[model samples]
Target: MSTSPVHLWGPVRRAENDGVRLAFDALTEGAGGEPLLLVTGLGANRYWVPDGLCLALAQQGFAVARYDQRDSGESTRLPPVATGNPISALFGRRGAAYTAEDMADDAAAVLDALGWGSAHLLGVSLGGAIAQRVALRHPDRVRTLTTMAAVPADVSGLATLRYIRVGTLAKFARLRFPDTADGAVAAGIAVSRLLASPSRPFDENAARADALRNLDNGLHDRQAQSRQIGAQWSGPRIDAITRPSLVLHGQDDPLIKPTAARAIAARIPGARLRLLPEVGHELPARAWDTIADELRTLAA
Candidate 1:
């Protein structure tokens, strides 16, 4: 298989609600008819949408668009950490301060900027949370929904070792080495380790290379990561999503547990859930084919 990275680029587009501009990459041209919008997870840029996955989806006749969430990739960042702690904003007693609803609005604004009235939506992890909110709040903008390794609010015990390790390491690394390139390298290594699975080992070297490439590409904007994390909405509100949906989760996922996926599937009316035993929190290269197949099936 060719490992050449898919080239994607876009100029910033200002969101209508706020002046926040979102950076996105679009893979168009070969798509037969349906357009797919991919929302990435926290701390990750559009590159997290694996190249193989994108090519597979493209081959299946879907124009795939993946973008950095606000505060992460090429997107806008929130106010400085001194003004407010983004993490605290999400978990405080104010009941999910920013909320996934706002994120859904942001996704809608992206589609509007693209001149697409509606499209298929796919989100991973935290991105899935935002996508769910989008589907619930703006059903008219979504043709179908596919959430992978995502959970709803009120769903506790959703963290995996990968999540814990990455979160802990990133926090500590930032505090100790804030202004150094080593900090970024260390953080990338931690994420790479966390994403690797024993049963389905990923190419750590490749992951590291990609991590560095992503960082060099100006895609690793830390402030944006904090903002996206701060904007999360937790609880059982996923029941309101009435669109045709598919939830994919790895049985061995260390971050959001499989049960979280089950809960999300249960709440969504007529949603389909698929559990893969060999996969993990990170989508391994080996499993791209299976995931792509499922997504194509759902899109069809």
Candidate 2:
């Protein structure tokens, strides 16, 4: 089934930390309710988060905000650095641009700009790893922590391979689209389809719509992806995350294995885990209510 088109909560706002500028927006001001910050997956823009999901969370009394990570979307793109083969960089020792710590601080910068001292963290995939680091680095800035389809923060190198689907990575490498605007949209839909569950009849409608709105095509930049994936975390382990946490995974996810979510839940004390059947790497419309309900409960 197709989902609704993306809805912009407000005009894009800027948040600066160190030298990097972040682009963010909120559906709610978060005055009388909990402020929720959404962190999307690797190379994904804030628009990647569906409007229906945000509305669902708003219905549950959450003031939700989503932002573009560094080098993605309207955010500042760092100077080009030679980060050879994104996969090689994934298991490398050093980042070509910045540290993962810097990325975590970006989230806090967005919170500061919004005038919210702290907010609940909801992250997906690479976003989930950032959320975990944010909680560890800035505990006071996080009320609750939730990670979806993410690997553990501390696990890297050969150990990380255990939780990944190598074939999926290969498929990502094979994706080809022109540099044109229409190409960006096509690339976006192609990537979404690859992440989607094989059991479900893939619908390009929602993906195509989001692609049209978020035409930046961050995914096509392999070096930028490398910098993001290569950034190492030297901070506290996930076990140190004391905030109330929830780990959600799709049982049928083809990109990241279910074990990745389990590993995260196991690392964080008292973190709850949920494996959704018939789901995939992409958050389908059918799972929006359940995700909202879980977030509401976690915030309470």
Candidate 3:
């Protein structure tokens, strides 16, 4: 995973994974800090996640780098693994273009680009699954593991049903954001309202602005996301991860049940599980401080 300096919009960090080019942004101001890689989930763009959250994590004596995984955000969009809808790719109906292991290797390449030998890894949902793979395949490159909204390799039908509610399932299946800026804003607001914490007020304007920026900067490809969803898994490797770990889940997560978090905690040796009350699929501002504190202790 070697990197060459590239300038796309600014000083965008770029790396290659299995013939795919990837882009990323770094929070490197913290001197002598450990590298903390933030992995976004599914079709999510790294920029969509507020920089303030990354900064807050950086302030905890770690250098943070959040990146667009291949196929999402500004990263390279490889050729389609299949011929049809991205969702079909998730099931390998056509034949997968890549597997989850390929994506996991991509994360390790980020550390290589930063010239860091090892770093703490954190991920959300699908990103969390990739992080677990990174710890298993490249153990020397991972210092600690933290996951939010992630489930175990072998998921239960009950856990999967949480997201199958009529409204949630319908909205998720028909997710669409237009290319225009206005369209982006509207889509962002809708997505925010859908994915945001129910206990917290929906910040429509904030979501709009974030969506606009993401649309302007990151590339959204349904095929890319679907291929990732459909990617092949190596095995049940979470139990093989030896690093100190933390598993954070929203008690009220509508997409994935809290039981998934406990299942994950049970597999990894010494992994701590913290289920936040009033939290949803997305981590609200209130939980960020608490999560940061937990990460700090994990490093300690």
Candidate 4:
């Protein structure tokens, strides 16, 4: 099924943090209702939320806002990798460093700039790691939390395996390719092929289109990806979070194993976990209805 084109309404006044000015798109059904803030994963722009999912949430009476993180999309870019290695930085060795807490702070700053006291927060993959930190660090700013395909503090089992594979691949890519146009194209092709696998349940045309759009948008800044990767490797402790939470995962996710979701749910007190059998790492456009229904339930 095809989704209606997304209608974005903003170059809204986003707060500046850490030498970066945030940019966000806000969709509201009305003035008085629960607001939902979406955070994207590593190497992703706001569009990664998917038009269908955003529209679904809007239809469910939520005022949703999705933004480009500091180094992705139209947001600011950090200096090129010079002395510090991006891969080493991820493992907390020796490099330019920023924690998921810092990212969470950025989110809070966005909320402040928008005059929102509190809102439901939803994040996917690395974004989920940031959301957990946000809810833990700024408990008052988050009403409800949903973490999709993320891991908690201690990395073990399949989550560790996935991280090792992704980190190693990313490191190799950065050292060898280093953001060249050709590298971007190659990466896009690889991603497209991976997502087109039968277990992924995605539209190949749309996947390719999104991949090329991302490349065209220059969304693969190495420094930003490095910082984000660092945050994910050493994520925050979620045990302190008291907010009602939902953890969603695809049983067939190749990148982040389903057990990671179980671990995340285990850490957050009383957090609910839902596992879908066929979905993979990428959130399919067809799952918009399921995502919307889940978010609505969380908001309620």
Which of the two candidates, 1 or 3, achieves a greater lDDT against the reference?
3
Arrange candidates, best TM-score first. Answer: 2, 3, 4, 1
* Candidate topping lDDT: 2
Tens-place lDDT digits, model 4, residues 56-112: 788888888877777676676666544244455555443345555668888998888
Worst-scoring 10-residue span by lDDT in model 2: 1-10
| lDDT (10s digit) by residue, model 3, range 1-300 | 011122211367798887888788776456358889888887777765555566567679888787888878788876765544644544345446776778888998887887889999889988888888888888889899998888774342244444334466456668776667766566656766787667777777766656655563222345666666667776565787898889999887777777779888999999999998878778666777788888999999
**Which regions of candidate 4 fall more than 4 Å away from where they truly are?**
1-8, 28-32, 81-87, 153-186, 195-197, 200-202, 212-219, 232-236
Worst window of 10 by summed lDDT in candidate 3: 1-10
Off by over 4 Å in 2: 1-8, 29-31
- Candidate 1 lands at a TM-score of 0.82
lDDT of 4 at 273: 95
lDDT of 1: 0.67
**Model 3 Cα RMSD, 1 decimal:** 4.4
Please count the clashing residue pairs in each candidate, in the order shown: 7, 0, 1, 0
| Candidate 1 per-residue lDDT over residues 1-300, each given as its tens digit | 123534433444454547767777676445455778988877676766777777777777778777767666667755655314334433341223345557778898888877789999989888787888888788899999999877774332333232333454344334422334655655555565664554676676776676665552222444444455555454336787778999998877665567778878888999999997777777777778887888888877
Q: Which of the numbered candidates is closest to the native, going by highest TM-score? A: 2
Cα lDDT of all candidates, in order?
0.67, 0.86, 0.73, 0.69
Alpha carbon deviation, residue 41, candidate 1 (Å): 0.6
Please provide TM-scores, in order, for all candidate models, with all chains considered together.
Answer: 0.82, 0.95, 0.87, 0.83
